[model samples]
Target: MIEDWRQRRAAKRITSGDGRALKRLRWWQLPFRALFYLTLPNGDGRQTEYAVDIPRRIDSEGGKARAHLYLDGRHHAESKLPAAFPVEGGTIEMAISAFGLKRCHYVTTAGAQHRLIPDPRSAEGRRARVEREHPTLSRSISHLSALILLVGVGLNLLQLAEPMSRIPPIAESIGTFESPVRLPIWLNFALAVGAVLGSAERALRLRYGVLDRAGK
Candidate 1:
């Protein structure tokens, strides 16, 4: 229903590519660049490779970032953020959030979705490595990220409720309310920073939710 409509809107954002060769990932670009790959059957007893490239940093003047789709290491197509690049078996979808990439997956015609493999030199790749090499530590870190976001959300809602309840129309209707717990200015700033870091960490693992978006 609604999902189909959203998919159609994303499809309309695609545009033809200029057919440039995909460049190799560079050392300096590791921090601010993300690359992912997917392989699918070509229907000729062979397989084809597809890569998605995205720049992490967004230009203030440009407004939004763009995503590049590569086939066999050559540019095939591209679109702005929240893009959907049609491919042989399905569509490769890419989207970003304020902290980092929140979605990068290949949705097949049959409806199954698979996440693309991150480039070995990229931050996502490193996070995947940590998960593979150290399961216990990885789980601990994942849980911590969730805990931080939970605390941030709780405190933020509490703080916002007090001010929101004081609005003229609301105060007259439901009386004024005061926050149960108020932190110092510095503590509030620290919590805000933690919320950002927590969201960024979840992005590395491709985990995002409505609460995270609301916090941002």
Candidate 2:
């Protein structure tokens, strides 16, 4: 029921495009832009190519991130972040994170989901290549990213608990609490940086979780 509501809400946000040609992904735009493609067969026995283009740093319509949908290279439709653009056989759903895209996929009418193929020159494509060529190393890096986020979440909760426990109402019930592990300011700063990098790395592979999303 909640998913259906979300889809309906997203559907309302889409707007028709002006039919401009989709811009080519430039070398310098790779780090800040994401482009993905999907090909689907039509009832006429022909294939249609759809592309999703996103400029991660750019905002539109009052500071909201936007995504563009292209049909065989021409702009077809657009919507704000967390969008759902209805397509030939399904909907192209997209959402962004502070560091990059958290989600970009095609959800079919029958409920099967497929991630779109990233443009070869983009950061996501590079990460996908690494996974294809070095599965073991890719797995190790993914694991490490998760571990970093977990540690970040744990430390954050511990620090937060100390402050919350100091509140008058809480102190009366639980007494003032002290964090068992307190690191130096420099170490905390380093950990914060690590968390951002870890979250970005996970974003490159389209992996997102609540804890990692907070770090981002």
Candidate 3:
């Protein structure tokens, strides 16, 4: 009976602690419809803090990417990849999560003239690694972010449809209003321009991450 109880307890522990590492999702913060989430052992067992911008591009069906890794206030890893590349050129990838530890996967395919390495250490080396291990995953993340942002902005613009539906009529009505109460089209346009410029500035500020992927 004692042995049976011991066996039962051992089985319980094994079931609960399967020993498979996993990334944990802590929280996500979104700015400009861009989300930055925290993880440790969840996405990739990298144990590193990462920032990503899911993207929306016209040429590709989908994409997602690890935007960058946090090193101080700056990003340690960043990439500028076109939305679509001939599959033959290769790929880039990243994984992030929150847990006891972290792991990341990277993979790539080499062309006839280019060499492919299963294990890499340099900047290009790292990029190659990403391509090999997580080609599709990388692109999906990047594409996703852009798609979401574009969709969000589109929705916002849609809301203005009702108000803007009668622009010419509204303009005529405004003319009859007292000079003190009248809002000129030029003034409204200027306000819009200012808001757009402000949002752009914020996007620029979000820029982070620099990878010496070439191992330089």
Best by TM-score: 2
lDDT of 3 by residue, 43-156 (tens): 454553333333222213224222332322333344322111112123223222211001222223542222222113222234345556888964564454344444444444
Off by over 4 Å in 1: 59-62
TM-score of 1: 0.93
Deviation in Å, model 3, residue 138 alpha carbon: 33
Predicted candidate 2 versus true structure: per-residue lDDT over 35-69, tens digit per residue: 99999987898999999998876574458888999
lDDT of 3: 0.32
lDDT of 1 at 109: 92
Instruction: Please identify which of the two predictions, 1 or 3, would achieve the higher lDDT against the true structure.
Output: 1
**TM-score of every candidate relative to the true structure:** 0.93, 0.94, 0.21
lDDT of 1 by residue, 16-86 (tens): 77889989888788768999999999999999999999987664665779898988988888777888888
Error of 1 at 156 (Å): 1.9
Which ranges in model 2 have alpha carbons more than 4 Å from their true place?
none
